[model samples]
Target: MAIGPSAVERWLDLSTEELRAQVKQLVAARLPGDHSVWQAIRRHPALVPRIRGVLSGLAASAAGSKDEAMQKVWISKARSALDQEYVAPVKAARKPVVKEEPVPEPEPVIELKEPEPQQKQPHKAIPTMLFQEPS
Candidate 1:
């Protein structure tokens, strides 16, 4: 349905939070204590504009009537619009984290060796005897 000029002006004038507050107020007024629709809207809040559109359509069609039946109808329409506009896709669950085991340290090594013995030589004294015999 085409949005009215006043609706466009109202939407442009209000902040996002204000618009949401207005939607929440309307939902609360129509369906008091019903939180499923509001919870869905809170989770995927981008659907606020769609909910506003549905509300505006209801207002335009009803022309400022405060009838209980009509308000119930508006609430029903708003819930359905929220459901259709913000259906979330199924997401995969996250995996658990794993811890690694600590490694053991190596042992120190040591070695020992014995020293070697030295050899001795003997001297000859026959030079004096040879000289005396020659004399």
Candidate 2:
């Protein structure tokens, strides 16, 4: 696309003095949060543009580095640090309470006996008398 007169005017209108002032204001507005970098970024609209600029600069720096291996290492470390900062701590589980059932005791056994005595029978002798008759 051609740089039309209007586009040129728009570009010229962006004052260098104003840009510098905005950048300074951004640096002052920036603050850190306990959870994440974005948490801080989302709170301050003035700092958001500045932070994006810094991140873009970092990416450009990484891309420009002579050693691709070193650039990858730096990127990996940055990602791991960001991940560790926002992760919440895990809580321990509590032990469950168990109810015990009560068992009933067994009843005692009773023994029965007869106390009455049995009567004994007495013996009796029978006598027979026999007489001879004369013819």
The number of the candidate with the highest TM-score is 1
Stretches of model 1 off by over 4 angstroms after superposition: 1-29, 64-135
Q: Which candidate's lDDT is highest?
A: 1
TM-score of each: 0.27, 0.26
In model 2, which range of ten residues has the least summed lDDT? 1-10
List the global CA lDDT of all models.
0.54, 0.44
Residues 17-90, model 2: lDDT tens digits: 54334333333334223434434334444544543454444556558568655545544443333333333446
List runs of model 2 lying over 4 Å from the truth.
1-55, 80-85, 97-135
For model 1, residues 1-135, the per-residue Cα lDDT tens digits are 123223433544566566655664555455432344444453545546656665665556556566756665767756664555334557989988778788786876766666566666566665655445555
Clashes of each: 0, 0
